[model samples]
Target chain A: MLAIEDLHVWYGSSHVIQGLSLTVPAGGAVALLGRNGAGKTTTLRAIMGLVARRGGRVRLDGRGLESLPPHRIARAGIAYVPESRGIFPSLSVLENLTVAARGTGWSLERVFETFPSLTERRDHGGGALSGGEQQMLAIARALMTNARLLILDEPTEGLAPLVVGEIETLLAGLKETGLGILLVEQNLAFATALADTVHVLGKGRIRWRGDGTELAGVPEITRDWLGV
Target chain B: MLLDPTFLAIQFLNGLQLASLLFLLAVGLSVVFGLMGFINLAHGTLYMIGAYIGLSVARSTGSFWLALVAAPVAVALLGMVFHVVLLRHMQAASPMKQVLVTFGLIFVGLDSVRYIWGNYSHGIDLPAVLAGGVSVLGETYPIYRLFIIGLGLAVLAALHWGLERTRLGALVRAGVDDRETAAALGIDVGLAFFAVFCLGCALAGLAGVVAAPVLSVYPGMDMSVLILTLIVVVIGGPGSLKGAALGALVIGMAQTFGQVLVPALASVMIYAVMAAVLLARPGGLVRARHG
Candidate 1:
């Protein structure tokens, strides 16, 4: 379980995330939907401690994670997959996976099994992999950390339709395995399908929050807040 | 004269010897700059300290072998202290600030060595076992120079194996590739970088001890080798191991052969090579992938 309350972040004079609060229950999915520069990415960054949070209380399973470093936060069971996929270009596919492996639950064999495309290119450099494969490798790497919570930023962005379907299927399976996922996505269909609850963000504030099914009838939220 | 087999063979060996020293000096500088983006102008100071420490150890123990081992360990420990106390703080500072601080450290290191040992050249006695000459191409050559070449190759091989086949090497590669991602994956990058920094310092010490017998230990010795080492890193591409190896060899052979072949232009030939390399590939022979 993850809980973030009244998170405030600033980039010099510009306020990025202003008093945002959210929660993801164990084995549940929460999707943050917003347009460009709506602070969705900033919220994820604040949770990961990549950016300094001026004010916030982040708790993972009742323990405070506000002051921890990024590495410490990761080890505490949060695995972050950035928008770029964060693959080490010089490292081989296998090295990229093993570099962050926590030696529990997800073994190299399991990852290879889960991602057969990756298995074939185990010796290939991470940079050499295609966009679809890179995204798969990123998720697979996150799993290798044995993390209970997976934080993904725009995993479906710039992906092919067929590859998007594959990723959606893979994530659906992961959701069934009781892994809590907090996803920031622009694809409304993908987000609504995978997430149990959806929150539309507008100008660093949550404009609407409700069940994924309820979001379909509320066209105004999607039109005004998410710019759909 | 250039066609003479014996003369060419001797020059070839001389070039190798110079390359060996350059490799030992440049590898650490390359990796540190590449991984942490820390411009350590004071790295050569470690080499000078290693030589001074080696001289002291050899004099105290009357054993060149003992000095070789003791000097690197001492310098590495000293480097660890410096990193924790000073260098680590500079990691977040501007590059200009990092340069100024490290450059200041070069003077501090130089003045410290002067205050302790005074401004005079000293030499380490060649171990009796390696004191004699060996026959090569119908001419005798110093075995110690060959030993230097062998040592360099051995270190290179070891480094190659360590970096390619080990988990620590994987973490380092990952850190070098993307520090933020590596950290977010739960790697203690700061600790790993600390280990690397100490190793770099140790290698510099090894180079200083190894070169002392041939180059002799002297005041401002760090400055001369620092220039050559920096040139090697620049030409090799900072952060690339392969680049450092290739760059060191290139510079080493160029400096060695330049001295004999173009006596008038020898002093500026290495600089010319560097400029030509920059013109061809501004990123150097091998580029660090991320930046």
Candidate 2:
């Protein structure tokens, strides 16, 4: 369970996230969708304490996370998969997963079992993985931390269609496992498929909020806000 | 004399011994640079301090063995204090600032040693256990020098195991690869950096203590060793363990053999090797992850 109240973030003189707020209930999925430069990524970054928040509060359950650092936020059970995936090119696939591993809920063998494609590449360097494998590795690494919240920024970006399908299926399965997910995505269909609630972001503020299924009936909002 | 097998053998062993010392100094410099992008020009001063500390312990306890253990531990503790008090703040500072700050500490370190230890050069007596020469390749070599070589290899092996097989090593490699991401993964990256800086300091101290019997221990002794350690890191590639090893070997061999083979141009040989390596591979022998 996570909640954000009136979040404001700035990058120097330029204001990036302007008084934004959203929530992802326990075991629920919330998707933040918008066009490029719409502050979708910044919102996630601010939540993870990766960027300085000019104003507002972020709460996990009931505890405030505004004063915490990135590592502290992560330790508090928020696993962030950045836009870059952030895999260490020098480390092996197994090392990348184990480096951040925390609890008994997720083990090395468990991760390998879940992603059979990665089992064979355990000893290979992270840089050597294919785009799909890297994306899987990123998700697997998050799981290793036994995090209660999974915050993913554009996990499907630059991925092939088949890989995207695999990722979507994998995420859907993870949702069934009761992991709270806050996702930022440009892919409308993919977001709608997994998200229980959808929020369209425009200019760093929430412009629309509705059921995930209701978004398909509204074209004007998509055209004006999402450019989709 | 130059073509004699015994002379060449002795020279080879001498080069190895020098390389071992250089490796001890260079590896720490390489890792610290790689982890934080911070240039510690005062590393050689740490080495000199180690020798001074070792001298004090040896003289007071009359045990070279005790000095060997005490010196590195003291230097490591001192390094931790230095990092917390000053270097930690300069982590995000510019390269010029890092260079100037650390370079300033060199003089401070030298003068401080002089103030306490006097300007006269000192040496430690070799322990009886490692005092005599051992026959090798139809010649004899000081057991202490051989011990340095063995200790270097042992440290190298230990380092390799720690870095490759341990969890802390994985965290370090991950931090070196991407600092922000490592933090996001719940790793205390700052702590890792602190540990690495301390480790580097301890190794330099160890090298100084180990070399006390073989080299003069004096206030300004850090200068020549500092320059050579820098070259080793550069030619070996910054932040790479393998690079440090190769660089140390090349420079150490060049310096040792060059003295006998080309006494007139001995001072220029190591520099020439660095230039040649840079010309071929601008990133050094092994391109480190951060480099």
Candidate 3:
């Protein structure tokens, strides 16, 4: 479970993430949907301690995370897959996986079984893999950490239709395993399909919050918040 | 021409000897720079300290082996202290500040050595068993040179194997490639950084200890080796072990053969080579994959 309250982040004089707050229950997915420069990414970065947080109370399972370093936050069981996938270009796929692997849960063998294509490309460098494969490897690496909370930023960015379907399927599988997910996505349909609750962000504030069944009737929210 | 066998053999052995020592110094330089992105100009000071410490131990115990073992451990411990006391404070500072701080440390290290060792040229005697020369291909060469070569190769093999095969090496490679990403993956990048800094200095110390017989331990020796080792790391590629090896051999052979041919231009040939390499690749012979 994850919770945030009145999160405030600033880059110099520009206020990015102004009093934004949200929560995700165990084994559930919470989708934060917004357009470019709407501060979705900043919220995640502030929680991970990658960027400076001007003010926020971020808690993972009721424990405070605002003061911890990035690595200590990681040890608290939050795995982040950035927009770029964060694959090491020089390292082989196997090394990339093993480098993040915790001692227990989501063993290498299980990961191979889950993503069979990764097993074949185990020795290949991460940079050499195709965009879709790189995305798969990125998600697989997050799993390797065995984190209860998986924080993904645009996990489906720049991928083909079929690969998107595969990723959606993988997320469904991961969800079934009772893991909480905090996803920042641009694709409305994908977000609506995966998330238990969807929050549309507009100018560093939540414009609307509703379930999938309620989203179809709120076309104005789509235009105003998401500019869809 | 390089076609002459006897001349080739002699120069080849000489090249190996120089290259091995160069590798010892450059590998640490490469790793330290590659992983932490920290520029430590005083790395060669570790080599100098190793030589003095090893010389002192060898003279007192009359055992070169004891000196060899003691020197690296002392230097490594010293490196740990150096990292914790000073470098750690500047971890978030700019590379220029890191370089300037480390550059200042070179003078500090030199003065400390001068105070302790006291302006006397010191050389560790080769153990009697390895003191003499052995005939190889109608040429007699000191066994100690071969031993240094062997030790270097052994260290290289260990490093290559560890980096390419072991889990710790995987973590190191990951950290070197991207420390932030590695940390997000649950790795303690700070711990890994400290470990690597200490290890890099230890290798430098090993280079000094092994090179003592030939180089004669003395103050200001750090500058000459530091210059050459800097050139090696630049040419070889900062983060690459193989690149360091390649760069060392290239500089070593160029320097050794240039001395025989031009004599006057020998020391500066490596600079020419370095210039040529930069003009060609800009990133060095084997650059790291990511910037």
What lDDT does candidate 2 reach at residue B72?
93
| Lowest-sum lDDT 10-residue window in model 1 chain B | B282-291
Q: Model 2, stretches more than 4 Å misplaced? A: A52-54
Query: Candidate 2 on B74-144: residue-level lDDT in tens?
Result: 99999999999998899989999999999999999999999999989998998899999999887888999
Query: Quick one: RMSD of model 1?
Result: 1.6
lDDT score, candidate 3, position B55: 94
In model 2, how large is the Cα lDDT of residue A5? Answer: 95
Pairs that collide in candidate 1 are none
Off-target runs (Cα >4 Å) in candidate 1 are none
Scored by TM-score, the top model is 1
Instruction: State the DockQ, from 0 to 1, for candidate 3.
Output: 0.72
Q: What does the interface RMSD come to for each candidate? A: 0.8, 0.7, 1.3
> Whole-model Cα lDDT per candidate?
0.92, 0.92, 0.88
Q: Put down candidate 3 lDDT per residue, B1-291, tens digits, no spaces.
A: 656787788888889999999999999898778667778899999999999999999999999999898998999999999888898888789999998999999999999999999988887899887899988777898899888789889999999898879877777777777777787778887887677778888898889999999999999999989999999999998878898999999999888888887788987888899999989988789876542
Model 3 pairs in collision: none
Decide which is better by lDDT, 1 or 3: 1
Q: TM-score order of candidates, best first?
A: 1, 2, 3
- Give the per-residue Cα lDDT of candidate 3 at A6: 90
